[model samples]
Target: MIKILLVGCNGKMGTMISTVAQNSTTLTIAAGFDSKTEGNFNYPVYDSLTNVKENVDVVLDFSRPATLDSICEFVLNRKIPVVFCTTGYSAEQLNKIQGLSAEVPVFHSANMSIGINIVNNILKTISNTLYKDFDIEIIEKHHNQKVDAPSGTALLLANTIKDSIEAETEFNYGREGIAKREHKEIGIHAIRGGNIIGDHEVIFAGKGEVIEIKHSAISREVFAVGALKACEYVYDKTPGMYSMDNVVNDTIKF
Candidate 1:
């Protein structure tokens, strides 16, 4: 059985993952860390990673990027495997995560829904194969509490699509009063609303036709399963950077 230390244990995703862990005989919650947890679970509750023992097989994070440095330090110092499902990291922070991958296994995914990731893969392949035939645009809707615009997942889709297009060029976050769509520019729009779980859509437009591919997540538990899957994937792997793409065992489209 794999033991998990869950970060952000007071949040919705954390609670969902806990329930999932409780149901699975192959997994257990070793400990949880949260700034706002009201009380204890069956296991320990910690407010600081420094106070927590590195006794678990894996650490799963769904917290803010602000907490990343401390978490990375904990993982590196403890030599523990990690699955980071949080979004909103700067490029330098991402590089830092990659840096630690040289010493300990790490998996990070903006979207932890396996089916959504598979859709991203297919979008990459199609964009690469049909660059001239399509004009690409992405729109993502997330919960109101989400801070980032043009969600990490939407960017993942757009970036994957860009990777496939040979002459792929620019990423346009949104359009204004008088803008023209460049053939190479991929458009991304972000929507935040009340109680929305998650929704993503990729539009492929051409002179004569249009195609749209979409994915909607109804529950946070899907991401929990994905995080758990990442734990399983990186358990025996070398210390290196990985994404859900790697966990899903699909070739990088580009």
Candidate 2:
């Protein structure tokens, strides 16, 4: 069985992962760490990863950005493999994760859905092939409780597209004061409302035909289950940084 130390185990994802682990013969949800809900599960829950005593095969993270530094510190010191499912990281924070990759396996994804991974690749291919001829735009919708606007998935998708095209596409989020569209700019829209899980649409505007792609997630289980899939994939990977694309492309496999 793969021993999984789940961070943020009391959050929505934590609860879902715990429930999934219970039914899986190949996985064991060994321990958890969360400030929000403690002592609610049979496993021990600490406020930080430092207090975790189990020798886990891998760690599944679904926490916020605020806890990233501490989690990295603990995981690096312990030489533990990690699968990161959290979002809302700055470039510097991302660099920190990159730095940790030199010592331990680290897997990160903006949207854990396998379908979104396919969408990301499609965006990359389309951008590489026709970025100069078409304009790129991304719009995302989330629940009202999500603190970050323009969800991280949108940024990751935009960045992947930009890198693939190498077109230096400028990003514009939420227009204001009579702003107009620019061919060289990519517009990103964020919508927040009641109970929505996640919805993302990517539009490629061309002269004759406007091609659009979309991915909709109606349940948190999509994310939770995907995180588990990541855990299984990255369990014995070589020490390095990896993304959902790695999983989708079969570049990082168990």
Candidate 3:
């Protein structure tokens, strides 16, 4: 069994992961690190990683970006693999994560849902085939409590679409004024309301035809499950950076 040191064990995603892991035959929550330590968890919860005493196989993090430093420190000290499920990290913080991969396996993804990763692959094909004739726009929706705008998954899709096409493409987040839509621009829009698990829609607009590709996450369990799969993928791997694409590709081959 993979013994996971779960960060942010009191949050919604953390609790969901704990519940999912409990049902799995090959996964167990060894311990948890969270600022709020009053939650009734099956495993022990500590306010910080430095206080953890469990023999953990991997660290699965769903905490905020503010916790990156401590997580990195723990990884460096313990030389263990980690799967980061949190979003909204700054470019500098991302560089820190990349650096950590050189010493320990690191799995990071903007959105951990396998379905989103599949959609990402499909968008590459669609963007390459239809960019000349169609204008692309991405709309993403999430819960109101979410702090990030345009969602990282939306940006991931936008970047995937942009990179696939060989042109000077730029992102336009929510148009304004009366400017004509440029063929070289990818429009991104964000919607926040209620308790939306997640929703993303990509539109390819032509003169008379509009082709839309969409993915809707019905529950947080999808991400919790995906994170566990990522943990299993990197449990014994060498030090390196990994993503959901790697996980999906490996599963496809199996």
Candidate 4:
């Protein structure tokens, strides 16, 4: 069994992951770390990781970026693998995560949904073909409670297109001011409303046709399930950085 130290255990995603783990034969929540320590959990919840006593094989984090330093310190000291499911980390914090990967297994993904990762792969395959002729635009929708604008998944897809085409591309977030659209600019739009699980749409507009690829999450459980898959993938691996792409490649044949 993989014993996980779940960070942000009181949050929605944390609770979902816990519920999912309860049905898994190979997974268990050994302990939890959250500022709000009191909860209706089968496992003990501590206000800090330093207070955790249970032996854990991995750390699954869905907490805010503000907790990254403490989490990094804990994982480094323990030499345990960690899966980061939180979004909105700054470049410096992301660099810190990359640095941590050199010492222990670190899995990070902006959107931990299997379908999203597959879409990411598909973008890579088609970006080279459509980028030169097509004007790309990405639209992402999430719940009103979401703090980050232009969800990480949107940026991920934009970056995928940029990298695949091997060209300099600029991102335009929600255009205004009546400027003509630049040929090399990719448009990104964000929508916030009531209880949207998650939605992402990519528009590739060409001379005569527009190709739109979209992924809409029906429930938050998709992310929880993907994060758990990431947990299993990184559990016994050597020290390195991993992503949902790696997990998808390992599990999906085509």
* Predicted candidate 2 versus true structure: per-residue lDDT over 66-157, tens digit per residue: 98888888788878789988888888998998999999999988889988889888776678787878888899999999988889888888
* Residue 105 in candidate 2, Cα distance off native in Å: 0.8
lDDT of 2: 0.85
lDDT of each: 0.86, 0.85, 0.93, 0.93
User: How does residue 155 of candidate 4 score in lDDT?
Assistant: 90
Compose the digit string of candidate 1's lDDT tens values, residues 1-254. Answer: 88888999888888888888888877788899999868547788899999996488889998899999999999888787999998999999999998989999998888988888889778766887667888888989998988888898998888888777888378998999999888888889999999889999999888889999999998888988888788777777778888888866564343
Report the CA-based lDDT of candidate 3 relative to the real structure.
0.93
lDDT of 2 at 242: 79
User: Clashes per prediction?
Assistant: 1, 0, 0, 0
Residues 107-193, candidate 3: write the lDDT tens digits.
Answer: 999999999999998877678889989999999999999999979999999999999998789999997789798888999999999
Provide the lDDT at 141 for model 4. 96
Where model 2 places Cα greater than 4 Å from the true spot, the runs are 251-254
- Candidate 1, pairs of clashing residues: 128-164
Candidate 4, which segments miss by more than 4 Å at Cα?
Answer: none
Quote the positional error of residue 65 for candidate 2 in Å: 1.2
| Candidate with the larger lDDT of 1 and 2 | 1
- The residue pairs found clashing in candidate 4 are none
> Candidate 4 on 1-254: residue-level lDDT in tens?
99999999999999999999999998899999999988899999999789899999999999999999999999999999999999999999999999999999999999999999999999999988888899999999999999998899999998998888877888888977897999889899999999998999999999999999999999999999999998999999999999999988987865
